[model samples]
Each structure stands twice: as C-alpha cells, then as structure tokens.
Target: MTQWLVLAAAIAVEVFATLGLRASEGFRKKAWIAPVVLGYLASFYGLWLTLRLGMPVGIAYGVWTACGVALVAVIARYVFRDPLTWKMIIGIGLIVAGVLTIELAGVVH
Candidate 1:
C-alpha cells in the first residue's frame, strides 16, 4: 500500500518537475529551477523506495510514464491555459488505454 502511494507521489512530483521545466525557460530563471530540482530528486527517491518494495521496474516505469503524461496534459490545459482539443484528448485516452492494457497483461515481455 505504501509502495503504491510512493509511486503515486513520484508521478505527481515528476509532473510538477516537468511543468517547472517549462516555466524555467531553459533554467535561466531561479524560481523555476529549485522546484524542478527538488521535485525530481524526491521523485527518484520515491521510485527507489517503490523498487525496494518488489515492484517490477518495467511495470512501475510504464505506469509512471503513462500517468505522468496524462496528468501533465490535463494540467496543462487547465492550469497553463493550453487548448484542450479533441485530438489531444484522444491522444491522452489512447495513452491511458495502452497503460491499462499493459497493466492487465501483467508480464513485462
């Protein structure tokens, strides 16, 4: 249970870090860099803990990437004023479906 929580936290942190990167504008600004760095550090550490809990690396990674991308897209549209076109929603839906398939498949290979 804690492992799953950690993975969730890691994904959220990673999303924030990615958003911070966009705001950082190539790390020229100080405000954005700090959160980006800390967020990534915390995310990586959380992932490490998840692995220690016997989570398969590939499965954990696939979940992380898919969820992160989807969440980021949604947040971008709402928080960053990005357009939420049908195409974007469809893309995100596909990503979610793919991730669900992978989770259901259960084997990495």
Candidate 2:
C-alpha cells in the first residue's frame, strides 16, 4: 500500500517536472527551473522508496513510465493545446495494458 502511494507520488511529480520543462522555455525562464529540478529530485526519491518497499524494478518502472506518458499526454492536450491523435491514444492504451500485464505477472510469481 505504501509502495503504491509512493509510486503514485513519483509519477505525479514526474508529470509536473515534464510540464515545468516545457514552461522553462529552453531553460531561459528562471522561475520554472526550480520546479523542474525539485520535482525530479522528489520524484526519484519517491521511486527509491517504492523500490525499497519490494516492488520489482521492471514492474515499478513499467507502471511509472506508462502512467506518466498517458497522463502527460492528456494534460498536455488541455494545458498546451497539444494535439492528441487517435494513434497516440491507442499507443497510450497499449502502454497501460503492458503495465497491467507486468503487474499481473509480478503477482503470480
């Protein structure tokens, strides 16, 4: 339970850092730099905690990255007016499915 929460926090922070990277405007904006740096630092720390809690590296990373990609895509569509094509949506769906498959495999092992 705690590990899951930590993983979720890590993913959320990574998403925030990714958005902050866009807002940084090629690292020209000073204000956005802080969030970008801090968010990544915190995110990695959370991931470490998740790993220490016994989640396998493959399962943890698969879910972490997949969720982050799907979430950032949706958030970018709204926040940045970025296009979310059907193909991208399908790809995201597949990523989610792959993560679930990994998780199920972990459970059975």
Candidate 3:
C-alpha cells in the first residue's frame, strides 16, 4: 500500500513537471527547470521502488508512461482548454489497452 502511494505521488509529480515545462516556454525561462528536474528524479525513484518490489521494469515502465500520457491529455483538455477530439480519445484508449495488456501478460508469467 505504501508503495502504491509512492507511485501515485511520483506520477503526480511527473504530471506537474510536464505542465511546468509547458509553462517554462521551451525551457528558456530559468524558473521551471528546477521543478522539471525534481519531478523527473522523484518519478524515477518511485519506479525504482516498484522494481524493488519485484515488478518487472518493462511492465512497470509501460504502465507508468501509458497512464501518465492518458492523464496528462485529460488534464490538458480540461485545464488548458486544449481540444479533446475523438482521435485523441481513441489514442488514449489504445494506450490504456496496451498498458493493461502488458500488465496482464506479466501476471501470467
């Protein structure tokens, strides 16, 4: 349970960092770099913890990235007024399916 919490916090940090980058304006501004770097570091450490728990790297990374992409897109559409078209939805759906498939495949092994 604590591991899951760590993972969730790490992903949230990543998302915030990504959004911060967008605000950073191509990283030209100095302020956003710190948060971006910290977020990535936290995210990696969280994944490391998951790996320590015997989760395969491929499966863990796949699910983490896929879900991150999906959630980021959702947040962007709602928070940033970015358009969420059907095509975008379809792509997110595909990512979700792929992640789930990878996780399930790992379980069967």
Against the reference, the lDDT scores of all candidates come to 0.87, 0.94, 0.83
Please tell me which model should have the higher lDDT, number 2 or number 3: 2
Residue-level lDDT for 54 in candidate 2: 92
Each candidate structure's TM-score, on Cα atoms with residue i matched to residue i, is 0.88, 0.97, 0.88
Put down candidate 2 lDDT per residue, 36-63, tens digits, no spaces.
Answer: 9999999999899999999999998999
Give the top-scoring candidate (lDDT).
Answer: 2
Residue-level lDDT of model 1, residues 57-78, one tens digit each, is 8668888988898888888887
Please list the residue runs of candidate 1 whose C-alpha ends up more than 4 Å from where it truly belongs after superposition. Answer: 107-109
> lDDT by residue for model 3 over 1-109, one digit each (tens)?
6666766776788888887777788899989999998988888888889778777887778877887898888888887777889999999999889888988988899
TM-score of decoy 3:
0.88
Arranged by lDDT with the best first, the candidates are: 2, 1, 3
**What TM-score does model 2 achieve against the real structure?**
0.97
lDDT value, residue 31 of candidate 1: 92
